[model samples]
Target: MDERRNRMDDARFDEEIAAEVLPLNRDLTLPENEKPRTGREEEAHIHERKQDYAGIGKVTGIAAVILAALSLFILPVFFGGAAVVLGFIARRLGARSLGNWAIGLGAVSIIISLIFAPFF
Candidate 1:
């Protein structure tokens, strides 16, 4: 009968509409339980980077001084060579503090080593 056909067509149309409109992703169906990440992780990441840069500068500066002193004793006139090497490395690594410190300490070490080299 015409009435029955109309009813069946209406049901089929609703089913087709629901299939198209419904979300295909199951994850979307789930309720949003997880909250956003706290600032702790971001803060820690920033802190670690700051500490890392500071450490690099400190260690390289100290090493430059040591190398300058040692090289002056063993080698001829290779003054501040180690410092120059490390200072360049620091610069390349974007360690501005460390590179500056390395150059400064190396200069001081070279001067002191030169003054003392004559004695030893």
Candidate 2:
């Protein structure tokens, strides 16, 4: 009886294995009209896709630097604050070097302005 039961279990396991394996054996090729993508083609496809922010990051970074420079001359507090905000925005958008420069320049402008404000 034990031998018979083992044979039954083996038969069930075989059926289960066959069921799982049959689907995987089907044809996986694309249709005659379609061609597979090469590595470079896939990369180019991804590169050509438009990003949400596009070139806004670099623009913000440039604007931040300009604001920081202008802050050194007039409306130091206002322009410096704007420059710092734009710098942070640029950093968040992937302009690390420009953002850092803008931040530094803005801080220096604000400090200098404050120091000279009492006299002028």
Candidate 3:
């Protein structure tokens, strides 16, 4: 259905944005030379970490997004609240893989939960 497609599109969009933002974010405090021994190596490291974050984030974000979306159709007993919390912690701890993702997903889960909480 159109709704499902829209959800997928949103997920994809979020993922792409996260992919871009997370990298620029990770190296914020580090000096260029200190980041990696060489430019190629640095790029590799950044790419590796980025992919890792993207994978984990996709899992967490997709889960939360699905649950949030389902809340509208099913019962609004929205799950994924925990994943959001984890993401926040990850974000705070410098675990880009976990943190930035958690923040975004947590926000979504919280918002959806608020919208659905009255139902349950």
Which numbered prediction scores highest in lDDT against the true structure? 2
Candidate 2, which ten residues in sequence have the lowest lDDT sum? 19-28
lDDT against the true structure, per candidate, is: 0.63, 0.81, 0.55
After the best TM-score superposition of candidate 1, give how far the Cα of residue 52 lies from its true spot, in angstroms.
Answer: 2.0
At residue 33, what lDDT does model 3 achieve?
A: 46
TM-scores of the models, in the order given: 0.36, 0.56, 0.33
Better of 2 and 3 by lDDT: 2
Better of 1 and 3 by lDDT: 1
Best by TM-score: 2
lDDT of 2 at 111: 92
Clashing pairs in 2: none
Task: Rank candidates by TM-score, best first.
Answer: 2, 1, 3
lDDT of 2 by residue, 1-120 (tens): 998788865624443345442243224345566566799987776666435444777888999999999998889899999999999999887788889999999999999888888997
Off by over 4 Å in 3: 1-36, 73-120
- lDDT computed for candidate 3: 0.55
Query: How much is the lDDT of residue 105 in candidate 3?
Result: 55
